[model samples]
Target: MKAFVVYCHPSEDSFTRHVRDSFIKGVVDSGNEYELSDLYKMNFQTDMTEKEYLRDSNYRTTPGLAEDVLAEQRKINSSDAIVFIYPVFWTDVPAKLKGWFDRVWTYGFAYGEKSMKLLQKGLVLCTTGHTKSELKKYKLLESMEKVMLGDRLFKKVHDAEFIVFDGMTKACDLREKNWNKNLETAYQKGKNLFAPRS
Candidate 1:
């Protein structure tokens, strides 16, 4: 199986980058092929042009998608599984990724008479400054999952999961404490990407 990884972090010197690399290594070792869209590195255009917005709002699917958007859509159709790796910013994905959705999830592709293929799995591996317990205390974790899994990946993938590598902010002691453990989990997740969930 092939996995399409949408990685969106701006810095190379980050725990999130380590998580991404470890996961890719595991996927390779498991004998699976993968494609990567490093949004920052590739300078992915995330903004939705006025014309683009109008087209979606009007439910127009006349085959005039931007090349970048079309490229991302092609990646989704080709891959058997999709993986999203990034850091949580303001209780959500970074702006670039949000824009990626806005621009790429056009009418008749990701929604509304969709042409996108149903994938085997959808997985999110996100790092956060807050602890999972803290996010749960305020129901933020639940909200995040609902948005990502329930809305975005819903009906697009047969199986879906959301994973947070939490408490990794520079000011948090747990950042250092959980570093290796979190990376190992990410690697294992990739290694078992195609395995049946029990």
Candidate 2:
């Protein structure tokens, strides 16, 4: 199986980057193929043109999506699984990623007479400064999962998972303590991504 990994982060000096690399290593070791879209490195055009906004808003099935958007759609359709890796920004994905959705999830593609394939799995691997307990206490974790799995990945993938790499800020002592452990988990997740779906 092949996985399309959408990695969004502004810096190379981040735990999230490590997570991406480690996971990819595991995927390679497991003999699975992958395609990567590093949004920042690609300088992805996230903002939608007025024409696009109007087309989607009107539910128009006009086939004039931007080249970048079409490329991403092709990636989605060609892969068996999809993975999103990023740091949580205000209990949500980064603005670039969110805009990716706005532009790529176009009419007659992601919605209305959709042509996007239904992948076997959709996975979210997010880094957060807040501890998991804090996220749970306030139910922010649920909100995050709902946005990604319930809404965006809903009906888009057969199964989904939301992974939290919590307490990852420099201010948190756990950052150093849990760094390797978290990366190990990421590697394992990728290594087993297409392992009979168990």
Candidate 3:
């Protein structure tokens, strides 16, 4: 299976990176082909310019990123599944990571105003947060789900799964344990999501 892992974290020595690496290890150990897109390492531009937005193009256009976006779109098109790993700040994704979305996931490629078939097949969201899981837990917190899965990623894509790992502020054995557990869980989920269909 081919998996595209999109990781978003500023600090290279951060706990988020640890989680990302562990997850990648699972994919490697499973003998699956994968691609890693590190937003920070790429120094991706996150904001869209007014003039670029004004253009009537269906796909996202940056000052100097037309070719790059096209390249990413081709990668996404070839992948069997996509994994987005990042640390949630203020209950949202990093600006650069979001920018990756704005720039790459274009209309004709990711979705269409008419046809609704998403170019990508499987979509998985593996995310972390600074706060504890209990604090952010809410019964009606489906907004993120809808936007990332239901609306954006899943709108064009068919099969999808949402997996989240919360609580990272308090660092200790407990945090490590939970994080590892979540990593294993996500790994297995990714394997299943990208498994070749019979």
- Residue 69, model 1, lDDT: 94
Per-candidate Cα lDDT values, in order, are 0.95, 0.95, 0.64
Cα displacement (Å) at residue 182, model 3: 2.1
| TM-score of model number 3 | 0.79
Off by over 4 Å in 2: none
lDDT of 1 at 21: 97
Query: On a 0 to 1 TM-score scale, where does candidate 2 land against the true structure?
Result: 0.98
Backbone clash total, candidate 2: 0
**Residue range 1-198, candidate 3, lDDT tens digits:** 677788888888776787677767777777887898888888767776565455426353323547767667667767767777877665567778788877675554554542223434555454544434443466323555566777657555556666666655556455666866776776665555556445
**In model 1, where is the ten-residue run with the lowest total lDDT?**
59-68
Candidates ranked, most accurate by lDDT first: 1, 2, 3
Model 1 steric clash total:
0
Clashing pairs for model 3 are 118-156
Roughly what TM-score does model 1 have, to 2 decimal places?
0.99
What is the per-residue lDDT of model 1 for residues 51-111, given as tens digits with 9 covering 90 to 100?
9999999999987889999999999999999999999999999999999999988889999
Write down the TM-score of every candidate.
0.99, 0.98, 0.79
Q: Which rank order by TM-score, best down to worst?
A: 1, 2, 3
